[model samples]
Target chain A: MSDHVVSRRRLLRTGLGTIAASTVAGCKVLDGLSAPDHRLRHFMERANDLTMAMQRGVLDRDALAQEFAPVDIRQPQRPNGVTDPQDADYVAHRNARFANYRLEVGGLVHRPLSLSLADLRQMPTRRQITRHDCVEGWSCIAEWAGVPLWHVLDRAMVHTSARYVLFHCFDTIERSLSGAIRYYETIDLVDARHPQTLLAWGMNGAPLPVPNGAPLRVRVERQLGYKMAKYVRAIELVDDFSGIGRGRGGYWEDRGYEWYAGI
Target chain B: MSRNTPPGPLVRRHTRVTRVTHWIWALSLFFLLLTGLQIFNAHPVLYWGDQSGFGFDNTVLRIGAVDDRGVVELFGWRAGGMGVLGYSGGAVRAFPPWATIPSGTDLATGRVIHFFFAWVFVVTLLVWAVGALLSGHLVRDLVMDRHHWRGLARDVRDHVRGRFRHAARYGPLQRLSYGLVLFVLFPMMILTGLAMSPGVNAALPWLSEGLGGRQSARTLHFVLAAGLLGFFVVHMVMVVLAGPLNEMRAIVTGWYRADAQEAGDV
Candidate 1:
């Protein structure tokens, strides 16, 4: 027999042998990987990484989300998650109509900022009508007005070591048996520097409503609605999100959703 | 008793590439459907136009239920429409656990399964397209000719009447169904799927726009998936009607027993 035929037969034999072995031990293998404390499956991580890489490699860094005409804003944006936070501090701020509310921006920065709503509005601003796509299979278009996040990062003199921007929110999505936990989200520096990444405080020519994250919210336009942390309380620059909330980068992400929910 | 029956020789029907790709497509599609439904159950309501949520009058379909004390709530809609989807007494379940992967509301697991199989489905489709082109299977087997057009009505009628003749080549109705699936439905599914991705939206903004918007694209994706499911059901029925063992063997082993009457075509 020719060498090619011999090698082909050998390869097929080995392949079949491996398949048989795996099939025999399939239940055990699955059980081990599916243990409660197991890390995210390698295949899931690989898929997410591949998607992230493909998006970053193919698209321009500054590519914008599709902007809509004013007429396209047909319906009011729906409030998801905790619309009204009942926490003591949040309640105090709400009673004052957020007069005492100060957005603290610190961590890995030369100048930390404690900016109020009035302070934020005075800065250079952009208004664009864009669609907010939820992971739950719905969308809404509304005009958002806010200062670009990068401009704030620049004013704060973000250190070169800073790789991510994390948002701390006022709403508590759940108070589980473990403990009370607040909502938080994070984005990489690339998204942080995007022009559409805004600290939005206004919607559709009016101040944001309590149901829709009044006072402030982060708008990473190229991401799904979950990434846009609402009822913003603070912004912190970090080298990594390993120490943040179960180390999964965001609230929903820690609970099983993909961190990079670009879809 | 007759003693002069002739044995027919086995003929090559499906190519090795065709068989492998066909199975891959079948497996991936199965997983995709289960996982896609799991994802859909996260938000069972579908809408049209630009936006949809509470206070939006844009719901095209909803799957919900009524509770004790006649409090009807279809995932937030206070209405009563129960024949197709909603139920009474039991908890409101859009698609039951049996229909979903993980058999629970695990969007993360659903997404992972969906995405992994999506790559498998797309890659297999591309490979099949290339193989079909090179093997002339696209032209010789799938495409209908002028003669086929003339006999299309008769072929459809015969199909409906259960008067199918065992033939070496596919009939016009088969070609038409396969052609529509291969060309129109699959491509629409892929495009609509991509349009829902914000990453893909950045890469190709026009894709989402052409489909009306991300939400509209999502609606289209569900609609097309349902179309594919319909095709699958019909395909399965046809397979059983046409002879399950023979059809299965032809797809699996790439060999089929030629009909004695259709020997002339071969």
Candidate 2:
């Protein structure tokens, strides 16, 4: 009977030994799970790619996000990230009511042009109420009125070499000894030209609030809220975003958020 | 391991599919729970509607730390989730660092780990469903009948008395709990999770609508996770009560000790 108990203890000892061995080895493995270029992180990034591919392939590219009624726009759209910009230039533009503001369209475009806020408001417009899903497991529904993003890109005639559209914002999301990093975002042509992609200038029938991107923001309806670059001042077409902020394609992406937040 | 050949006190209690999926579940759930906590700490509050932000009263739960002070509010009830939740070490994040992946406040890393395991969990669950159907394990073992209900009282009494018997394959309460986990809890977790995805909502609008919007789905997901944790705690206690070695060996090696009369009867 005692020997039987002894055997069980031996089994436990062996089990503990295996766990100890794994922990010793797994310390490095687990600690590096989020580190860039590590094996576990490699798999995680690969999984992110898988998620993006599966969503892109399985779902219709132009499927519209659920649109709620006007009554569904409860309370107000919750502003997030850099809600207010203290940048001297942005303050001057705000002070001037953005009368001199120009939406600069450059990079891989056959006809690089800069248009005033009035010029953009004159383009093709669409209004829809959609939910804003934040990366932090919260959501807000709001009615947005804006010109279709494709209209502007079409006017500029994005060059065939262009593969992605980058949005430059007026808000500085971060600043330190490394200097101020203004907000920016990138989207593939598919999403950039999606029928619902809008350069929104108004929210809930009013001019966009200072807290909610003010003059303009890009609304990529099919993605998380971060994809919508707020406080927009410029749009650039590019074949690659490798030369942009930290080369991750967006301000948040550079800080470790996934570039593709469709989920 | 054949049904009829091993005519002694040893019986094959777990099939290969069951054992493999069980381990997969154990590993995935561990990471899912911890990493899930990490994600939760990012917002640290849950609401029950389509929208949530400042100046609203829809908050169902909130946890935070202020000036090294930790607090938790559920509905209107308040408590200090000092060490394990709101505050840990010097961090003022929800759910302590020890409970999170990366052991620091890294939402991006937590998200990556969460999504990877989420895919693993999803694919494995699909594979398990098909495999379970083909193997008769779902029907033969998991399905409960009048016979199972009849033994409920006796099984309850035996468990309370610490008098385990090898009278039947599984106890009625055990089957019920396991059935709920397999058929109900897990499915709800997946559905709620999918509902929170804006991408999925475009494809499956009815899912979020049925669940009362995306934020509601997030709320349900957290509640369901809590249910799973409850089930795990009860499961562990039962394992210890019924005999840990025998249970562990049954799951790990598919071999469990049974009484002489019960042997070869299965």
Predictions in order: lDDT: 0.80, 0.85
Winner by DockQ? 2
Query: Which of the numbered candidates is closest to the native, going by highest lDDT?
Result: 2
- Please identify model 1 stretches exceeding 4 Å from their true place: A1-41, B1-7, B53-56, B68-84, B264-266
lDDT of 1 by residue, B32-89 (tens): 8877987887887777665675665666667765552232343345765443244432
Q: Considering just chain B, what TM-score does every model have?
A: 0.88, 0.93
What TM-score do all the candidates reach, one by one? 0.87, 0.93
iRMSD per prediction, in order: 3.2, 1.9
Residue B108: error of model 1 in Å?
A: 2.5
DockQ of each: 0.38, 0.63
Per-residue lDDT of candidate 2, residues B164-184 (tens digit): 665227667878899999999
Q: What is the DockQ of candidate 1?
A: 0.38
Checking candidate 2 for backbone clashes, the offending pairs are: none
